[model samples]
Target: MIAVRISIVLLLLATLFGSSLYWLIGQFPGFVVISLGTTALQFTLWTGVLAVLALWLLFRILLSLIRALVLPGLHLSRNWQAKKQHKNSQLTYRGLLDLAEGRWASACKLLTKTAAGSELALINYLGAAGAAAELGNEEEVNQLLALAEKADSRNELAVALTRVRLLVGKGDYEEALPMLELLHGRHPTHPYILSLLERSYRNLQQWDQLEKLLADLRANKVLGDEALRQLEISIRAQQLTALAKNLGPDMASNKQALVDLWGRTAKSLRSVPVLIAHHAALLSQLGEPVQAEKELRRAITKGWDKELLTSYGLLGGELAAQQLKTAETWFKAQPDNPDLLLALARLCQRGELWGKARDYLEAALELDSRSEIYAELAEVMGRLGEHDKSLQFYRQGLLAVTGGETQLMVRA
Candidate 1:
């Protein structure tokens, strides 16, 4: 409308000025009638042409201004869309992190709402499965893992591990074994996978496979020197037990195998007190009770472990009484050792050295008044025909118990 109005104003002014000039020309003596009419006609035609052109220019300017206003909105919309997509991507990433950190429900919600089958989505799904497993949402875990597997076959490790853990948790070792075999055969060097597989094999009592895999892991440096040595010792112990079970008490092959295992294990596993005790027990079982006795004594010198102390006396079999004499001598050197003192008290009670047992047990109780020590003392006192003292010690032992002590309490 403005363009039209401006065009009319321009056309009217051009006509008025041109007409006035034509009249002024006529008033001059030399103006011809035809010439003036032609000039006026030409002026009117040029004015209308200029008016259309001016209207077009005005319209173009308005159109350019309108585009300038609308163009920014278009760019802003695009930018907003890009930012929204980015935010969604970030939310997906955060969900994956949450899943890794065990936020199951948050992970599930994020993954379920985000784009599926993309690499990020697949990762999110995997994380959700793990989180779901932690949350005990077994059905959701299975579903998520399955979805993740469907999205990408490269997710085999994640899916398989989830399945293996679930099976292991359920004590379905038979089902878990096949998956472990597959993983071990395929990705034999994956530390995490191999670690889980080794545990599964150990649980199944598949010593031969466990030993072989443990050797591979050790060679690859997947397990540290200490861990590898410990695992090797465990494998040897398991093998020894299997051989001893199959070949019976007097089998020469069984005895020889046990001796060879113990001899090597003693050197490799010297740092691990538990494994050292195991090797000592194997030595004793293989008919080398004195050697086993020396190993336990050596271990005690290196480390103070109460479990090993208990196992040392139990490992000596028929030579237990003689081993106790040696243990007593060792205890004299480390007289204040609470575990040694306790072990001596038990040994003396077993040997029925009543006065010596009472003295040793009383000494142990004085050092550390554990319920077990009190309980043991009470039994020894009762066996020595000291009923009143026994009852009094029993009451004292009961009073010393902390919460959940009933679990540890055993009748002597």
Candidate 2:
């Protein structure tokens, strides 16, 4: 609309100018002369002005023609470059999506193809390296890593972490450890780096290092409450296992190490049933049945754990009698507790009190008909010289074991 208005205004001005020129030329009443190499010409003043205007119009048309001829190639080149860039951007985006979707081969091909053209070459190379790692193409991964390092040498942290992640994913902890340590030195408080380091240490079975790392993570609040609790339990368990390995045939030394570990552990962790059971088992193995019995009783008083109860019943010698007495005390408080009854049955069996074992097993079976209780009753009946009853209990136990699907045993 504006262009149309401007054109109309220009046309009006041209008409006014032409009329004024014609009027001025008539008032002058003069002629102009021009001589060429082989011809001479004379013209009125208006005619000469008209001739000059026509020449200027022709020059403009020729210039327009030249511009029209040259500009298309330049435009085509620019358009091609733009389309190429757009394609490269799309490839990079799709490759990232494919990587997220676990399409390793396709993502590797796309990302590697577009790496050179991608504006963020560092990111492209790193992503391609991850895909290559997923495909187990170690050589391609190294090449891409080198390219990423060259693309931006200052991004050492990102490149190193990428390498560490790939190595860890491939279960190459030995290779990942040094890279993680390097990152740890530079970014001591980075949660992701610390997490990776923790995993690497765990996979390498470097329990001592993991212990220290876990402490740091806890201090920094990198691990949440429940996660920290679980990690602490796992770290302590691994440490105990390591200590057991290094006990060197000395039962007393092994027992003392475990006792010291238990004493040093936080009370919250000590209250965990699994840890308690573990400590008790270690103590029992080291010939400290009394101490094992005490540990189990303390833990059970705090919380009733079936596994702990089972472990409690497994304590032998004079402690068996004492544990049985302790367990029986709980029977009044928990008269129908199947775990308590099972523990009592186990204690009776260990003490060779066949009658009491049979009674406790039957009572437990009445409360909770577990296959284990049936099997225990069968064993007790066999020990009591009741073969027919033993066979009957054994078949019942087998039926329970198979979820009553099929009875494979024959009748005695």
Candidate 3:
């Protein structure tokens, strides 16, 4: 409607201008002339106006023709680009999903293909690297990691973490250590980095480093109470066990060091039965029977531990009788406890109370027919001059050791 209105108004203005131009030309009765090289032209004022209007209309037609020809190509080009972008986005999304679903091969292919054109090349390359790692393609993993590093300098932390995790998962702790340490230096409190570092330290048997890392984890509350407690047990146990492996040139100094380590341990950890038992066993091996007996008694009184009770029966010297008395007292409360009964038998055997050892062993065997109990009873029977019965017990022990599926007949 607006176009029609404008066209009608233009027609009226053209008619009025033409009439005015004709009147002016009639009054002047003159012509304008132009010469160019070998061409000459002459026009009245009215005719020149018509010529200029025709040229303007022709220019509009040419402009419309140009637009008609070029616009579709531009639109097609834009559509093609939009389609390619959409396909790339879909491939990236599916690649991420594939990674989450453990489709390593497909994920690696898709992500690598899209990485060059991806706006988030960091994500694409990192995902591809993980997929390559999962497929055990070490060379491909390295190549993808290099691409990731080159794609974005700001992705150093992410790249380092991915490499560390992959190395750790493959049991390549030796190679993972330097990277982990580097990450640790930059991000001291990052939980996942700390966890990877902890695993690396453990795999390499770097207990001192593990202990320090565990302390940091505890201080930062990165580990929960139960997890921290378990980690404390593991780290302290490893440290003590390592110490026990090499008591050093000065036995006394080494023993004092172990004592100092135990002293510095958290009281909550010290109260753990298994840890106490381990510490006691180490002390006993170091010829510190007094301290060994002290730790065993302290731990068992608070809570009975089967391993600790077993260690108690193995303590020698004047402490044997005292430990036996302690075991008997515990037995009175837990008569049906098979481990405690076995411990009593061992303590009695150490004390040279043959008949009492035989009685405890028989009673324990009645409760639980373990291979170790059968072996202990067989030795006791042999000591008591019952050779025939000793052979039978030994055969029974063999049967138990073999999952009770084998039967053996013995004759003396």
RMSD of each: 11.6, 8.9, 5.6
Candidate no. 2 TM-score: 0.72
lDDT-based ranking, best first?
3, 2, 1
Regions more than 4 Å wrong, model 2? 1-80, 241-246, 369-375, 386-412
Per-residue CA lDDT of candidate 2, range 254-336, in tens? 76777788887898887788787877777767777778888789888676788888778776657777778888999999888
User: Worst 10-residue stretch by lDDT in candidate 2?
Assistant: 403-412
Best by lDDT: 3
Clashing pairs in 1: none
* Ranked candidates, highest TM-score first: 3, 2, 1
Distance from true location, Cα of 208 in model 2, Å: 2.8
Top candidate on TM-score is 3
Error of 3 at 220 (Å): 4.1
lDDT of 3 at 367: 80
* CA shift of 36, model 2, Å: 42
TM-scores for all candidates: the values are 0.62, 0.72, 0.80
- Worst-scoring 10-residue span by lDDT in model 1: 403-412
